[model samples]
Target: MSVLTPGDWGIEALWSALQPVWPGLSVELVDEIGSTNVELTDRLRRLAVVHAGGQVPDDAVLPVLLVARRQTSGRGRLGRPWLADPDSALTASLCLPIDRADWSGLSLAVGVALANALDATGQHLGLKWPNDLCLRDASQPLGRKAGGVLIEAVNVGHRRIAVIGFGLNVRHQTVPDRPTGALTEIWPEATPPATLARVMPALLQALQRFDQQGFAPFLPAYAPLDLLSGLPVATTDAQCPAGIARGVDTDGALRVQQGERMHRIVSGEVSVRAHATELPPAPGH
Candidate 1:
């Protein structure tokens, strides 16, 4: 499919795709197929902040969610673009009224809820810190990065609005040059978009709840899905390219035990470079 700009949002196609799946849910989708999820949300937030108390601009759509059928350049955290194919994923965003709240935390909460949704569908999904979903193949438990979440902050006066982006793999496919996987590979018969619709309500509800109670309420919710909690790992800043991830801190930074000191990395990509089968020979070797 060719890329679509926000101007090309054909409501009927967007509506047809989701109406059957997300019935009764208030989802206003735009047809911005070429937009990266992160950029799209940031644009929405900026518009809300810029035009506060004024009528919505002609080119602006506010307080509504955006879903792309063919997101040509959707991106994830650490500046990774989703290798989005029209039928393989759900590239979407949600808008919210942001105030003094660190509502960005909801991204993590949504990830956890999504894990629960996958579990409900008989899929065992694990969670990588910050907000990536993984699936472990018990026989070969080393897993794959299946999905990711992106959150951008938009200011509305003293208020901080947000546009949250999510990209999930629903088919048994992989992006040619990225470390991403899809649930359909694990569940051959599952409907990716339908699964998204089934799983999104809980995620939205959890986000709403967190907006009210803060991320504290979601700790228990996210704990079970923690994929590398105690596993020795290294975290790397996609930009700086160097980090050692020991574990997560109470505030969510990736902790790295380097000799006598431990470094907590709040932002970066953590890849499972060394799995069970690839252990070093011995201390002397």
Candidate 2:
């Protein structure tokens, strides 16, 4: 692994590329942090407190991209620990305001954006239902998870702030019982700085499109990349004990075929595991 310096991130270059997409965007890079998502959420919460006092300005909630060179206590969906070796992953969080009546498939939309951005040809990368980026190949069969997305939203006065956290393993690492995948498996030249630069613009654009059109625009793009499609799966929800994965619905819910009925597994409701083989535990339960 190449040693990454602070200059490798190219903060100004990224700002030049992404500033127009999101006005008042701020790009910040830290040497190390506990969790980018937690930090951003805490910042937003403080802003919210300020707003309650009528002292907050209108431009207070500007879009922010927080990058951590080394994240010590990173988190994944469902309150699981996402541990990554130093300089081995692209760990960051994006905070912005999203105005939508329904946020059902936002995470799926984000997944599609990241997958398409990182692997435009869709040959080596695909999405696991809800919010995981997995490797596409015959060796792993059902696709091995190489990255993931975790989103947390908070109501700030009249607006809503959504903090989207993402992690992509750039180099390979060995975890005791957790089988992991790395971007280098497909892109041998993958690096944290370059990888972040590759995906940020697409992610910003996707969020903008999602705010206007919702998850409908991303459904077709997500289909070809659905790793769990047509695979037998089991979930924690008793209502949908075991079934075959039949892709996702318009709202991004996991469509599971159980006997003669179809069950739409909503996000955050239950944990799902593909039964085609004894898959490793996902980033989150």
**TM-score for each prediction?**
0.72, 0.92
Locate the minimum summed-lDDT window of 10 residues in model 2.
276-285
Q: Which candidate number has the best TM-score? A: 2
| Root-mean-square deviation of candidate 2 | 4.8
Tens digit of lDDT per residue, candidate 2, span 1-285?
Answer: 567888888899999999888878999999889999999999999888878856555588888999998888999988888766678899999999898878889999999989899889998888887888988767665567799999999777788889999999999877677667899887888888889889988999999999998898899999999887767777766788777778887888898777667788885443345335532332222
Error of 1 at 278 (Å): 14
Instruction: Extract clashing residue pairs from model 1.
Output: 98-160, 98-161, 246-255, 246-256, 254-265
Q: How many residue pairs clash in each candidate?
A: 5, 0
lDDT tens digits by residue: candidate 1, 1-285: 344444444444545454443343345554446654565565766666678787654334445566766688767787777756666676777766544355535667777777887776434787788888877656433367778888887654445566778878876565565455677776675553465555666766666677777666667666667776555555565432333344454445555544445566666566654543232322222
> After superposition, which runs of candidate 2 have C-alpha atoms over 4 Å from their true positions?
53-56, 268-285
Best by lDDT: 2
Taking all chains together, the TM-score of candidate 2 against the true structure is 0.92
